[model samples]
Target: MTVKTRIYLVRHGETAWNAGGKFQGHSDIPLSERGRKQAKALAERLSNLKIDAFYSSDLSRARETAGILAEPHRGTVYYLPELREINFGRWEGLTFKEIAEAYGELSTRWWASPLTIQIPAGESLQQVVDRCTRAVAGIITRHAGETVVVAAHGGVIRVIVGAALGLDLNHFWQLRLDNVSLTVLEYHGPEKAILELFNDTCHLHEK
Candidate 1:
């Protein structure tokens, strides 16, 4: 009576804004040329696995990345808005320096205490954690004892990983989610999960 679920958590490939370190939260940015190649490489690496389902954030970059990976399996890709990146509000397209200059002390506070601070028209870390938790819970429930792949943004990945590991949102920075990197998590039923891998880029290195 042991149910095991294998989940492949992936961060979408690089985007134009990602290279520039600009905030792309909720932005429907497309993948860059290199990004597309990275996705293809990942697809090839994962093609042999028995992936039962594919899921991705509704954003274009994430969907495109997932599409490339799911092609070999002919897997059905589901888009969940809850998997989208946290909204950056007025800092949507700005870099850290730009945000610092514009909001000064408030920007510092936001970075230091994002769990409690809310950006203008943006979401708090807690809000993201809640949404991502619900989304992940639903996916795990629907695909119990199966293998699935999820392509999403870096922020979303962090929140999801943190929740799975029982880490605080403020400690999310400890997890590195490079573009096109693969992370694996195993769910052994409710409240039981294990991190098998994180930020794996072996496929990229092979290129």
Candidate 2:
């Protein structure tokens, strides 16, 4: 019998850029007012669970969300810069429409072939996956057999989910992670992993 490591993957609460449909890669943007409420609701929902440890992106949005979630669990949040969102370069703070209008084919090609095209002055998708994987690998190895919570950005979470499932990077973009949503990954050993839940936002609907 192999000991399992259950991971509660959480996307951070909404930020202004998220609401505005802007690319927030590595911007250190803080969450909006409603974002706090969303985090609180999720916190209340997970408060009863036996979350053994908490890890989060060092960005303010993810850090703050993880802090709220970790409050009732009585765990210190270990910040990981490697878990930060992909660097979008000049695309930061700009909407996709804006980027398209400005950069035209470059932006369009990026949306169509993200893995092949590199963003001007920014890190590539592969770079994002590399560092995020490094962070998650360390987290999983250190906390095996424990239920751990990882609060991070959507891009970061998507990278993790893609890596876990051995899915192609291009197809990984199809995964939609809403604000404060929870996805779970259960690892039965070094070779077997299962996605028990994905993008669950029921906790956000609490009265």
Candidate 3:
């Protein structure tokens, strides 16, 4: 019998750029006002869970969200730079429309087949997968049979969940993760994983 490892994957709360539909990429953007509220609500909802560890991306937005979520628990957060979002490079801070207008073909390819498209001077989907996988694998190995929380960017969360589902980089866009949303994944072993929950926002609905 194999022990089941559970991970509560959370996308950091919204940033000013996120609200504006701008590419945050690896930029160190802080959370907006609404994002802070969302994080508080999320913390309240997750306060009851028996989480053994808390991890977060080194970015400010993710780290801030993780701080709120960690308040009810041990109040400790381990930062992992590898869990940061896909580096959008030149595209960072640009809105969707601006990106499309500036880099037409590249933007089109990005939406159409993100796995095959690499942003100008930025990291590729394969790179994101590789690093995120190593970080996730390490987390699972260190805390086998326990539940842990990982607060990261939308792209990183999506990739991590996709990898856990055994999906390749091509299917990356299939999973959508909203800000402050919760996704639960259980790993039976390196080869066996299950998606118990995906993009759960019920906590945000609570008063």
lDDT of 1 by residue, 48-138 (tens): 9999999999999999999999999988799999999998888899998999999999898888888888998898889988888888889
The candidate that achieves the highest lDDT relative to the unseen native structure: 1
Instruction: Arrange candidates by lDDT, descending.
Output: 1, 2, 3
Question: Best-fitting candidate, measured by TM-score?
Answer: 1
Inter-residue clash pairs, candidate 2: none
Candidate 3 per-residue C-alpha lDDT over 10-64 given as tens digits, one digit per residue, 9 for 90 to 100: 9999988998999999989999999999999999999998989999999999999
Superior candidate under lDDT, 1 versus 3: 1
Candidate rank order under TM-score: 1, 2, 3
- Could you tell me the lDDT of residue 121 within candidate 3? 92
What overall lDDT goes with each candidate model?
Answer: 0.91, 0.90, 0.89
**Which pairs clash (backbone N, Cα, C closer than 3 Å) in model 3?**
none
Q: Each candidate's root-mean-square deviation in Å?
A: 0.9, 1.2, 1.3
Model 1 scores a C-alpha lDDT of 0.91
> What are the runs in model 3 whose C-alpha is more than 4 Å off?
none
- Candidate 3: C-alpha lDDT: 0.89
After superposition, candidate 1 runs with Cα above 4 Å error? none
